[model samples]
Target: MRNVVLFSFILLFVLLIFCANRTTKNESSSLQSLYHHAKVTSHPGYEHIWPNIEFGWEIIVGTLIGVFGASFGSVGGVGGGGIFVPMLILIIGFDAKSATAISKCMVTGAAISTVFFNLKLRHPTLDIPMIDYDLVLLNQPVIILGISIGVVLSVVFADWMITVLLIIIFIVTSVKAFIKGLDTWKKETIVKEEFVKHLESTATSSEDVEYKYLPSCPDDEPQKKINQGTILSNIQWKKFGLLCFVWIAVLLLQIAKNYTATCSIKYWLLTLLQIPVTVGVSMYQAIGLYQGKKITVSKQDHGTHWPLHLLIVSLSCALLAGILGGLLGVGSGFVMGPLFIEFGIAPQVASATATLGMTFTASISVAQYFLLNRFPVPYALYLTIVATIAAYIGQKIIDRLVNIFQRASLIIFVLSFTILVSAIALGGVGISHMIEKIQRNEYMGFEDLCY
Candidate 1:
């Protein structure tokens, strides 16, 4: 086991190095092309916020954000970019386009590192239902349509809409958070009948069940217990249907909202965060389906329909996530996470699987960005190298810190959302000033002059 783990770590490290080198090369080449073709007056926007935000500071903030995002994602079975992207755009002066691209790139590095760290630590079983080939086959057209539409929109309208949409998302998310907090406080003070009824419903769903199976062997020998048919028949088909419908509706709405938001904000960072948050919330609902279930099946039925169903659900979610990630430059794990939970996957397994899916989706997005010449080479190279190295280091630190907080998962998510809201409220360092500073380096001493 130790040898296997060590080998895995070494392999991941090597892969990281290779990916970093390749990314660096591609980014450098892209940068040169951008510089040559870009209008001399257009000046790449790197220097506008350079003086106000030091490289060290950016690295520190980026690393912390990655760590927080990774830790939350690891525990909640979702990607943390929902928080990271908004924070970067709002707090850092990155335009919507640059922020989304960078957020996806950063999330890819962090997710890969987090998965490696968790696997090395021998995290418990993550049992995602196998992808349903049938569902994938059935939904391929819808998924394709969504992806094609998203990609076309991304190319045509992503630039103008991302910022404005981000501001709106920020306001809405902030209001939601503040209201949730208030509700929590209010609930503590008064236990209304509705609240009590809701709690009772939740508790009843979480209650354990008792069952007994009849002996299968003949009386000639000692009787052996056989799985009861009653148990299988008792499967809550209605509840399952309800759960599936709720999650499906949530997933569709989230995708629609995300597409709408991306059309407006065009900032990849905020978009990255929004999509994953939607996925995570969806996963939370899925987990409820398996909260208190005991299934003892006969060997014959043990592997029958469940795996197929799981596979279909997982694939449907994963494909949707990948398409969105590819088109919008965010991790698709948001969609995958909830689907895994709904399909009866364990939390840790769901998280690991979701991260794995995000890794692929983010990679595709990065490749597409490169092919489309959406990234400037020097900036891409610098940011990718920095993010990758930092993510590796951050993962180690996050693993160590994970033990300190009992509810670290929930805390990390709340904090991530809070940071995002605050950043969005800040107006991404103001649009006019951002354009001016990028066009001319006049803002270099503005901070010091103001002070």
Candidate 2:
């Protein structure tokens, strides 16, 4: 089955590459037409979508680059937009705005694809649920609240500011992943040593009628099991209510902004429609929680404490992640998943639930961009298709590799390396741009930083 999945992915990738090349050959005129239409018809705030024209190799490169980004991203349950945006800017020579727009589209597609993959692979008996719907529900309101605020804050933060922020986030996240991994590795080693000492002691002791092995601590459990009732019963109602209030407030603000600006009915309608679509999943999960549905905890989380502090920290991280991710056209999962693991959520739960949040957030971000007509239609379409496929395959590849290697240290090391490289690359770009701005004395719409 593994071989078959691998072969299928290869075949699909090759086929898509062929299609991408062929499609680009004939898409120049259509792309030009789309640009012209968007320029003439798009609202004032979104004029940045209509860029100068290009064709041929650029399209292929963009698609191939997306494949690489999505594949790398899937390993860590990220949407690959971090890699996508940087590559588009420095490597592909796209302006920051265009790269962000395209990256949002790419993240949207990749997230939805992975969500579908999770759904398709879910089995009540044979397989553990990759996505934690209840957890996703419990967390979605806060995440949505964050994304909403982040989208608003995005405008206040200029391109350079956004770049600077991303650089900081990348560096901090890298350090956290490194420290967290090292700490966990040390704890596991100690546990293993203790287990071995107990075994040796048992062998030497004459009082033992039957040999009994020392059980590892909960932190070192092989699999996690969540207490569904406890999780549902202990829904941080105050925080949850606050998040819900924020969600509603943001929605109303959007409506007011649209109405006062005298934007088209279409924009108003899209905003209204988004509420139900975005919140519907959470509502459904809430209903399930009330319905007394059976909660399936994984092997690792069987008896762990679901603390209020954990919820607080997770939601707080989501808030910042949403803001940075929205501005930079990346998924919050890049930061959120690691934060979850750091906060004592099992790795699988962290990855799965963070992915669920990403899907919704990406959907919301994509819709906002699409409604504004800020997306590059044809180019985004191509990148999205390739990214979607590559992300799924990338995740599978990581899972298989994990099973084969069985080394937590190696996984952490690789993740740390990836994050470190990302920080350097993004920081380098931001610093270079800042230098140019300072030299030119053109700090667009901001006071002098020297002051």
Candidate 3:
């Protein structure tokens, strides 16, 4: 029944694409011209205040908040867009749309830094690189597909509706993460006590009591160990090639989308092409995992033990999380981080893997924003650099703390805290904005994408 339902969903999406293309020849040029006018005359986002703000002390204060947000978000494997967007809008004094673009710029920097660190690092117990490449291959494409859907809905849904949904989802996900963290902390305590007792009974050295699953490493680990050569060798090129192919395919499609007339045959054709690219690639990976031909190596010996249903559910979760991110204007990291924990992944590997995929999506966003000329180059560049440094430092500090305390649950706590803060901050911002829109007697109904 579930497989049938899932298949039907994909089929429906495909059918819609074909249906649009079938009317390609019937679409009149005048209709196309009207759409072109809409694209030129109106902004896709809700609000864009005047006065050309984003200067002065705003930059200094925004930079400070960006540093804190990047560090916390990076350490927790969330993209920190929740904090970045609000900071950009309120402190930096940018409009909503530009704030989102610059927010992605910050996310791109942080994700790249965190992913680079994870690439040359090993899993806590497994020999594989800390990132779960197979998981990325399976999850990312569908997440992108869902994001496209969410973007469409974002255009149509009123601000208040999205805000209410965001608050509910974030709060629920955060509570679940807190509970998971408590469970993990208790388990760690029991293990620590047992290890100490065993050492006393056997008169063993502390080093001999090191657990197989702990991320224990020499404190003197050299930076040179993660040089270009080591990083290249650590990567699984086959999986990476597939991931890159998906990224490039989608990127090219979006570039093509810009040249075509809005809502025209060419535009719809380009838009619909993404379905095959995203769903096709994700389906390929999902099937491979189900058939035991591939694995999420960070899962240790249990990688190949996944049932078909579990694979379907995971792909579905990725889609759902991606859609939520799109609707709420938050990063996928906020949703994906907690979801990965629930998938029973170790917090260390989960954070790394989620951020690895975020690197791809964030880069895509930055590229699109650049194409749209949405932000000033100097500001974006400066913020990006700040985020990169902050993320790198944040990851290092978190790794040190976790290892010192032997508590991976710290990452989960950070994830929960970040989500909770986002819920309160963003929810409040949206509610206030919604009230303002109401005061001005704005339309609160479905928006026309064509207009």
Candidate 4:
């Protein structure tokens, strides 16, 4: 029944794409003109809507691309935004800002949906914490700091800067994934009965089992609790208070900017009301943390003193990932996962924490992008829904096969190789585009690529 439902859902998506493509030639040029105008025209009352937006082959292809990217991403325990952004730029003819904005929205939606599933997941025979809230909160502050910086910088820079940075990020990540895949493949081998026993043990045992690809802390060691006297506990008030003030300030500025732009009174009013809703949620969490009700770190992990070096490295990586993620319109989950492993976190815990952090980063970045009117709002919601659903399906399939799949290394290798090839292709196109734009000494937008 589950398989049938999945197949039916996929078929519906395919049918829509096929029908949309079949009528591609019938897309009126006037509608195409409208799309181009809509992107650049800051007309106060004009909201880009259906019929005014170009709907044809590109969108269909883009949707399919998102599905494929998200499917592989979920299987590999990565976010799809990296692939989504590049493909949107190279194939769908979207500008860098637009691609990043839409990709961020998609990632945010997927992360939120996946988090929901992870939290609710229950096994009749197996008992475990599926979503590690403690680990997530531990990483949130630093990750949020990094993401905040990234979002500000993303909007501050020129589109070309983002494009160039994305090329570098893609190439580097591809190489890393390829190397990691080889290592993972070599370490995992299929032993049919052994695999079955392990799965059974996992279901029956309360003890943590360590797999080569997914390691756990020693079973003898008790899970650590946060030290009440730690700096994290003492400084929560300052931290949350500062964050609240900054976000509120930013919200006010956005409202002011909207008014100054002479946008419709409705636009500014809506922005004033809508922006606070998100900020309020963040502030609420911050308040909880400030009240010492949240555990942000473990005392045992720090011993008698703070692990300054660990803190520095983790935050630095997060900050760097944030910049890359914001510029590329991704959460950089693959990158963060390895960093978490290096920090000696369990694979399961790291995955959950990374999802939460990615969710926050993507949400904040997309919100900023939306304020700047960088997103294609009409298409964003639909595409995000599709990607989120696809991610959930892909995750479920991978979960069922996790214990049985012995050739994990081979799977990773193929996926990494494909990502590498795609990166190279995207890099080449980006470089060539940059060269042409530089030579012409002119600013060209996505409208130039309209068919």
User: Which candidate has the top score in TM-score?
Assistant: 3
Which ten-residue region of model 2 has the weakest summed lDDT? 209-218
lDDT of each: 0.43, 0.58, 0.78, 0.55
Model 2 Cα shift for residue 242 (angstroms): 17
lDDT of 2 at 365: 55
After superposition, candidate 2 runs with Cα above 4 Å error: 1-61, 117-128, 187-307, 408-414, 445-451
> Which lDDT tens digits does candidate 4 get at residues 1-451?
3974577487656756654664574455463543443354233444432222344567667778887776666544456766787777766676655676787788777777666555553211123344444444444544554454464465556556766776676667667766766655555444445655887866655445434333122232322111012333232355435444544555455546445534456645644553344444444444454455543342225323334465455556765775565454456575675565445443344555577567665666667667777676766776787678777776565544543453434435434554554466556656777888889897644321111
| Model 2 C-alpha lDDT versus the unseen true structure | 0.58
Residue 271 accuracy (lDDT) in model 1: 38
Give the range where candidate 3 is weakest over 10 consecutive residues by summed lDDT. Answer: 32-41
- Pairs that collide in candidate 3 are none
> After TM-score superposition, what is the CA distance of residue 213 in candidate 1 from its true location, in Å?
24
Cα RMSD, model 3: 13.3
Residues 1-451, candidate 3: write the lDDT tens digits: 3563355346534533543564464455462321111122135444443212222366657778987899899988887888898888787666777778888999999999999887777777666677888888889988887777787789889889999999999899889999999999998899888877888899667655656546664452332233213688779899899889989998888878877777789988888898899899989988888788887766554587678778878888999977877777677777787888888889988899899888888788789778867676656776787788778778878887887787999999999998888888788889989999999999887778777
> How many angstroms is residue 84 displaced in model 3 relative to the true structure, after the best TM-score fit?
0.6
Which ranges in model 1 have alpha carbons more than 4 Å from their true place?
1-80, 83-92, 121-149, 155-304, 307-316, 319-328, 371-373, 389-451
lDDT of 2 by residue, 1-451 (tens): 4774677567656656666565566456553543333442223444454443344455557667777777666556666776787777765556667777788778777776666555443211123454555566555655675565566566656667777778777888878888877886776567557656876767565334321112122243232122112323434364345444545554555545444433356655544554564455445444444443523243234223334454455456666676666565567786777776675654545665666667666665565566656666756776776778777776666545543433344345445556666667666777788789888998556432112
Give the candidates in order of lDDT, highest first. Answer: 3, 2, 4, 1
* Each candidate: RMSD: 14.7, 8.1, 13.3, 9.3
lDDT of 3 at 88: 81
Question: Candidate 2, 405: how far from true, in Å?
Answer: 2.3
